[model samples]
Target: MQIGSIQLAPGAALAPMAGFTDAACRRMAARHGAVYTVSEMVSAKALTFGDKKSAQLIANGETLAPYGVQLFGAEPETMERAAALIGGYAFDFIDINMGCPAPKITAGGAGSRLLLEPERCGAIVAAVVKESGGRPVTVKMRTGWDAQHITAAEAAKACEAAGAAAIAVHGRTREQMYTPGTVDPAAIAAVKAAVKVPVVANGDIESAQDALDLLEATGCDGVMVGRAALGDPWLFGEIRAALAGQPLPPRPTLRQKMEALRTQIYEMCEEKGEWTAMPQARSQALYYMKGLKGAAALRRACCELQHFEDVDRLIEKVYAAGNR
Candidate 1:
């Protein structure tokens, strides 16, 4: 699959999850087999104003090739400026985040709130595309702001008309934020039917089967995995296998899981320092430790962990126990 100048492998793509799909996590996902990864959503206004932190979010950090940088904003001018600025960065494409369900974003008439104004969304996409310097621009959006406003098909048409190369649709409206099993595959299907550009299905795809099911049901060209990838980057390879009609890959061995966990920890620390990275590292560790022997105790231990040295010793014990 191609997005502008970059060619993506045919498989699962990593969702641009804030606070999670950072550089370190994207690198891990790329190594494990994601076709492409998107950086966490950077604020367009911040980028326009030259916010160093937000601009830094687009910098390459061992992320695999074919990566995009996602941006969120309500204004066309700011979004266009941000897109133009990032065109010179290391990203392969530019993604507009019209799907984030967070209240802080939607309340400001950004994110999924863009669903309430399809024309304006199109204008924003058009301006960004024009300013993107011929880079492929994409859009990620939910079905609508709420059940009462199911506009994904309309939005998809708008995005395409405005020059988006591809659009990804999440199955839920903002009203169903993060609710399990609420994703409407029909909505994604409708979007695929409405647009000539490639459409990607995104929602609660947690397994290889989920990805295959989505592709079959929606006829989407791609699938974007979100929360399911927490500490489970290998899901992309498994999804690729399922799509190719191959047997599901084996689950990670105890040692392999431990090693992956350690690598994520060290990478997080390396990128964000030990002090600030620990809190989220603890959360990620719990996901890796899920369903393991003595997981309850181990989760509690991780929750209480404050120091990397302490975490290493505890992980060693957990690894030894699981091996036994």
Candidate 2:
């Protein structure tokens, strides 16, 4: 699948998850064969105002090429400025975040709130395109504000008309949050049919079969995986293999999973410093151990650890026990 000049080998793309899709995680996903990986959403206002933290979040583009930076804001000018500022950098694509259902974002009339004002959304897309200087611009959107306002198709059309290179449709209304039974394949199909640009289907794609089912059901050009990617970076490789009609690889052994978790935590500490990385590592370590025997006890140990050595020791003990 090609988005502008960037060509992605057909498979899964990583959703721009906040507080999680950082440089190390994105690079891991890319290395595991995720066709594309987006940076966590950065504030348009923060980018324009030269907020150091927001700028840092978008700084490491070389690590994940075909990299996309997702930005959010309601104002066209701020969004335009952010596009220009970020475009001047080495990013492969710029994505407008219109799917975020967070109340803070919606209260500011950004994110999914833009769906209710398609005209304004179009204007924002147009401004970002002009600022992007030929780099591809994409939009990620939810099904709609609610069931009463299933406007993804309409908003998708407006975005395409305003120069978006692609559209990613999450198959749920803003009101659905992350609930099961909320993902409507028909809504994804509607958005795909409404535009000539590529449509990437998202939502509830937790396994290789789910990814295949989403593509077959929606006829979308690609699929994006979000929550499922947590603790499971190899999912991209699985999806890639599935799309190529290959047999699935055996699940990682407990020891292998522990090794991957140790590597990820070490890298996070190296990149973000020990103090800042530990809390996040604790959360991720727990995610990595999900479904394992004695996981609750292991998670508590991980959460209380003060240093990387402690993490390494915990992982060693867990693997030894699993082997026994």
Candidate 3:
């Protein structure tokens, strides 16, 4: 598959998730077989002013190549300026975030709120495309602000006209806020039918069956793995295998899972200081540790970890437990 000028393998891609999907997390996802990954949501205002923290959010930490950075904002000018500033970066695409439902973002008239005004959303996409030098522009958005709005089909057409290379639609309204049982696959189908660009379906996809069902149901170009991939990057491999009609890979052993978690911890440490990285790594490690024997105790120990060595100690403890 291709996103405008960028070439991509035809399979599952990692969704840009905030508080997750950072450089280390993206690496983890890629290592496990996700064909693509998008950086966490970045503030256009911060990038426009050269904010170091925001810049770090999009920095290419790996030479692995082909990752995209997602930017969020409502104003066309500021969005264009932000894209222009980062146009020379090594990323493969500049993705616009029009689907975030967080109050912090929607209150600012960014994210999913953009669906409320389809025309303006198109203009923002056009501005970013114009200022992004030759980089392809993409978008990720929800079905709409609410059931009453249900405007993803309309917004999708606008994005296509504005030159978006592809669009990803999360099948929920802002009112659902990711609540289970609220995803409407029909909405994803609507967006796909309304656009020529690739449309990726996202929302409550937990297993290979779910991914396959969404693909056959909506006929979307691709599927994005979101929260379901937390601590479990292996989902991508499983999804990829399922897409290919191949046998699913075996589930990872506990020691192997711990090692992957260790790799993630070190990656985070290299990107951020131990203090900052530990908290972030611990959270992700907890996800990895979920459902394990003595996982609760191990998680508490992870909470107090102040150094990298602590992670090793926890790994050993997990190894010795052996389901005891």
The 10-residue segment with the lowest total lDDT in model 3 = 315-324
| Preferred candidate (TM-score higher): 2 or 3 | 3
Clashing pairs in 1: none
Clashing pairs in 3: none
Stretches > 4 Å off in candidate 3: none
RMSD of each predicted structure:
1.6, 1.5, 1.4
lDDT of 1 by residue, 1-324 (tens): 666556667799999988777777888888888888899999999998889889867877764657889999999988988888887787778899999888999887889999989998899999998888877999999999898999989988988899989998989999999888899999999999998888889988999998988999999999999888887888988998888889989987777777888888888788778887888788888888777788777888789767777668767768666643
Name the top lDDT candidate.
3
lDDT of each: 0.86, 0.88, 0.88
Alpha-carbon deviation at 119 in model 1, angstroms: 0.7
Q: Candidates' TM-scores? A: 0.95, 0.96, 0.96
Q: Which stretches of candidate 2 lie over 4 Å from their true place?
A: 61-65, 320-324
TM-score of 3: 0.96
Highest TM-score against the true fold, candidate: 3
Question: Model 3, 273: alpha-carbon shift in Å?
Answer: 2.1
**Per-candidate clashes, comma-separated:** 0, 0, 0
Tens-place lDDT digits, model 3, residues 228-301: 89889999989989998999999987767878988988888888888778877777877887777787788887
Note the residue pairs that clash in candidate 2: none
Estimate the overall C-alpha local distance difference test score of candidate 1. Answer: 0.86
TM-score of 2: 0.96
